[model samples]
Target chain A: MPCQILPPYLLEKIAACERPEMAHAATAARRSLVHDAPLRRLGDRSLATDQPSPVPRIADPAMPVESGPAPTVDRTVSDAEGSENLPGKIVRTEGGPVTADSAVTEAYDGLGDTWRLYWEAYGRNSVDGRGLPLDATVHYGQDYDNAFWNGRRMVFGDGDGQLFNRFTISPSVVGHELTHGVTQYTANLVYQGQSGALNESVSDVFGALVEQFARGQRANEASWLIGEGLFTAQVHGVALRSMKAPGTAYDDPVLGKDPQPADMAGFVTTDSDAGGVHLNSGIPNHAFYLAASTLGGYAWEAAGQIWYDTLTGGLAATSDFAAFAQATARAAEARFGGSSAEHAAVLGAWKTVGVLPG
Target chain B: MKVYVSRVGGVAGIRLTWQVRVDDQPDADSWWRLLEDLPWQSAPSGPVQPDRFCYEIKAEPHEAVIAENELDGPWRELVDRVQRADTDSR
Candidate 1:
């Protein structure tokens, strides 16, 4: 699946609006849907052929592997220049001077930050854990309302000024999309039904953690919001999805209420959105927030580590919420001892979210 | 006659539906001609790609659901026209 930061349900609400003032939003939503459809099809064909690995392996000859000591952070940011074409003009390369375009600079920096969090916190090199050079394309399409990682690289949209700002405006959004690459390389989670929801939840967890790590904030101090500043002042919302409080992220007249359900009780059962990957993700998202906050201190230290281990530790592609919950509990037990608070917290979190028995 | 074109499948899994009355459109005859000859019952059978789209096109009496890539010739033209017309109207 093409990992889009903005959920489709939100766009559907915007598209369905009858208000005269919402015409711009409606048009943008429809355009975004039309634009993203083929990209998803492209992603499917790519994944079917290529089996990615953590260890460095020659996949594409065009992207030559760097010799000598492994490069820590090799990033390339491109400018789409308001067209749909990806990896457009190479505006900035690794260790190069900052670009005048804030989106370009932000994409460059956000890639580094995500890399730092993964490498520093979990000892993973990059998205593929083998120092895979991060590449991003910003300013994609005219008034495009979404951002996504299309298997190989990150693509950001210049949002319709009516609702969203530049997608790269939020570092966690960058982290979130990049983490989709991480999920792709590791779990290879089937982006459908429960497994897909788990895939989205895992990205949200790391997205929030990457921000927390960058700001040097403990779990208690972190905002726990994904795409926090992506919304414009005109929109009545703090962020796209709230880890701390899922369904309460946004409730605007034009955008409608946030449809996320924070527990299994409210789990959305539908064939849409790959079985509500973004919607039902709130259940596992809330569980992660609970685990991290309950464990206290730097979330990356224990909570993040546990989740990281669960992700990279041979997680099945088709694993569901219960399976993921059990894996995290196991990871916590393994990392911090069976009797440790981290293990108890992990188990308690799943129980609280109704993913596990109380 | 009214034509309802809905696109489903994508990472978000949300469906987009656009309804257009044939008489209201400038290309009404073109739409009617295209729909008349379309293989309404012959949908491509296979697993849907992770985030790819499949379209369900209903033009009153006839309906067809075709895969994103499977769309061809007049069917593609009709879908494109309806989507463009909807966006233009908005």
Candidate 2:
């Protein structure tokens, strides 16, 4: 387990404190990683087959009891019925409303749209490519500052609302969360070390692609940034992370600089949270950016197809960057041919990211 | 009070039952408000019978609080408010 995927230097940074309590917490968290690592290995082995989930059904009060094919639940139920009479989406919208509506509504809408797109675009339904209903929740904590797909439904925090506004509003943010579900369904990639980084990168690639496709933007025209519109104007530039240029996304003093490394040499290899999945995703993020740019058209059409095919076609749980590169190459060849331009583009992109064989 | 949640044809649904010690309970209205306030789109029609109601809440995309005791803050306030209304009518 190496006590976490973070470098000892970064772990030291997190442990920066003379206070005994703070130091003890960090030490304990690091120690806990030893146990978690082996369990993760077990998970990798278990993930080789389709994971079983408790299937959920819609329980609409208005509908009569009838059993046939389940009706596709209309997502815009709250909107369709008048707000005065109908039930509000998640939290109440009108009188005595305890939860904020905008964040929850945005998250809900984004999940629905992303689910629909995944279904409509590639004839794949829902997160699992089955007709699984997409699930999400917003306003998770008082000032929670991150959003994640926690092996199940999507959960979004309201954010500090200072550095980051509501996370649900960004299409890329929702896309990122949904991609985690997709990754869970298909690749079932183990979350640690280089493999974990690739997992994060895959989410970023799909995240940006969802945004690009939503906006009808070509790859060249795309900004290639993840969470581009998430930050308030006071912070600095556009986004929390950038796929096109890895570390250059944000350098503000408050949130700290984006620590993603663009090449294999700079790859982070600590063991916290599945080997710093968020940190090392930079390498794969940059690789996808290169692939999309090289393809020189809508990313969803070519690069997205290659990646999606690779993911759905029985991917190993512990596949690392090199393995992923080979898979993408194989997928591209299977999709476009061994000597095709798309295959060449895939190779070139992996090479650029230093994932390809020397 | 015993609440029953059953799954019928894969559709998980909620059924509510409450026992009252007092006849013609004055706090029933408050209970209705609480039931209506639950974060579910599929609830039964208004309040039902003397002290029973049925509703359904799907468990996905969001989770909701299903039960609360009268001693709890909001729930206590509701019972108090209802009791005061009954006293005034008498």
Give the candidate number with the greatest lDDT.
1
What TM-score would each prediction reach against the true structure? 0.76, 0.59
Model 1 complex DockQ against the native: 0.21
Clashing pairs in 1: A273-B12, A273-B13
**Per-residue lDDT for A104-147 in model 1, tens only?**
88899899889877865665778987778999999988776667
lDDT of 2 at A290: 87
lDDT of 2 by residue, A1-358 (tens): 1224665455456534446556444433333332233344445547666633312221212222444553241232122111221233445222223344676567666765676446434445577765666666565544545566655666666655666676676888788777878877777787657766777778788888778766657798998888876777778767867888888887776556767789888887753334456667888888888887888866776688778767776668889888888988887766555566888999998898788965
Q: Which ten contiguous residues of candidate 2 chain A have the minimum total lDDT?
A: A77-86
A6 in model 2: Cα distance from truth in Å? 53
Off by over 4 Å in 1: A1-70, B1-18, B33-84, B87-90
Q: How well is each residue in B8-64 modelled by candidate 1, as lDDT tens digits?
A: 643223355767788897877876787787777775644444444667788877777
Instruction: Please state the interface RMSD for every predicted structure, separated by commas.
Output: 4.2, 20.8
Q: DockQ of each candidate's interface versus the true one?
A: 0.21, 0.01
Listed per model in order, the count of residue pairs whose N, CA or C atoms clash below 3 Å is 2, 11
Q: What's the lDDT for residue A9 in model 2? A: 52
